[model samples]
Target: MKKIMRSLGLMLALLTLTVVVSACGSKPLSQRNVLKTDQQSKTITWGVKADTRLFGLLDTKDGQIKGFEIDLAKAITKQMLGKDAKAKFIQVTSSTRMPMLKNGNIDAIIATMTNTPERRKQVAFSNTYFYAGQSLLVKKGSSIKNVKDLNRQKGTVLGVVGSDSVENVAKVAPNAKVLQLTDYAQAMTALKSGQGQALTTDNGILYGMSVQNPDYVVTGGTFVSEPYGIAVDKAQTPFRQAVNQSLKELRANGQYQKILHKWFHNVKGFDYEEAARE
Candidate 1:
């Protein structure tokens, strides 16, 4: 009897373990979610930037995130999944966004990420939401103005290692020294320390930086065009389409414009018409 009881207990334990693993690997299983938006499963995870100031940042008073990107994401979620869809924010960096999406940690990435061809290979992108151009962030009153101005004499151009902007800078300023930082924060720091003459990245990001510090300014026109898009795993075409649909709906309903004007209009040097175009 003791042997039989022990065997039964082990079988039950094995069954529990199998159930737990299956639940972890697979999304919530419900036949009803096949066609309908799972209203009961009203949870949408969005990947957003935590460090970027104007674009996305933590509001100390409310203990909530407030930014142009986050607002747009919320509007999209409400339009697609209804008001009940509780939006969950996941802090993601330049390198973490792709892996988080691929592993299903995030439903979409709305961070200030550019839709590069290389990134397209790994994920699907929506309609061009915001059009950005690569530019230089230099110290206020600095002489550096444009990529054409870059030469061996000036100084190093700081860029994050994995960012598409690094390659763009290399192509644009072959002779200029290039320093690769791990992330945008470090690159900006290097620029401040005089380790690099200027930092090259998307103008939209530089716009945020310039707003925060009058001592820093973004110089030069765009050397390369970067179109912002919402990204999802390449394999999740259905979800990708749904995201695009939400974006389209937001645009049609004027929600997109509202979100844009709320954060961006107040931002200095922002051109709305220019950003909406591809």
Candidate 2:
């Protein structure tokens, strides 16, 4: 009787595991293997970067999120549902974007995430909305002029933990000493303390830091092309199409351009038309 009872317990555990895996595999979307904004019986949560300045930043005093990415997300939410789709925000960093999507913690990720083939395996991406690139941020009047000018053996670089942006730096400077910080704020601190000769990351993020300190600048040509996209779970095909279509409409009606102009165009070195193109 004891042996029989133990076997039954094992069976139950296996069943539970199967159920959990099934839940992780898919999410609610009108299209198979994509996400859609079809029905609105519930509110949708979007994952955004709370620490990155230009892309996503928290207004501590106002208790609001304000940035180019936030504005775009709000516009998408408004277009997908009625004027009142009711959207909530979840703070996500580079490391949290994928796991949160798989677990259904967020319906979509509108952070400055790049659409790469490796990431595509885990989550489906909507049409590319923003065009940013991997660039180097260095102290102004510093000797570092470009990637080719970087002395990997001599310079230390700071990056966010597990970020795709950091991966590009390795390829650009094979021998450069690299350090990973937890978030944008920590990374900036490390840079300011002279822990690293330079900080390498997305151009949009660097733009925010540049705004705060004109002494530091994003220098050199864009080394790696990074196309930003809205991320949905790989199983939510329908929802992905709907969201992409909404973005298309935004571009067709000139709303997309306005958003870019409002936040990015004002930043020096940003091209509104180029960013609008896929």
TM-scores, one per candidate: 0.88, 0.86
Clashes within 3 Å, all models in order: 0, 10
Determine which window of 10 residues in candidate 1 has minimal summed lDDT. 29-38
Residue 23, candidate 1: Cα error in Å is: 6.6
Winner by lDDT = 2
Q: Candidate 1 local accuracy as lDDT?
A: 0.80
Candidate 1 local Cα displacement, residue 88, angstroms: 1.0
- lDDT (Cα, tens digit) per residue for candidate 1, span 1-278: 99999999999999999999987668632212321443446667899987777678878899888788888888777877788776779988888888887766777889988988888888789888888899999997877878877764556899876578988988878889889988777787888888988988888888887887779988888889999998876665666677788888888888888877877776778889888774
Query: What tens-digit string does per-residue lDDT give for candidate 2 at 1-278?
Result: 99999999999999999999998666444233322333544356899998988778999999998888888888887777767676678999888887887776788999999999988877789999998888889999888888776763468889998588778888878778889999989999998999998898878888889988788999986899889999987777777787888899999998988888888766888766667778
Backbone clashes counted, model 2: 10
* Model 2, runs deviating above 4 Å: 1-38
Question: Candidate 2 local accuracy as lDDT?
Answer: 0.83
Give residue 98's lDDT in candidate 2 (0 to 100).
Answer: 78
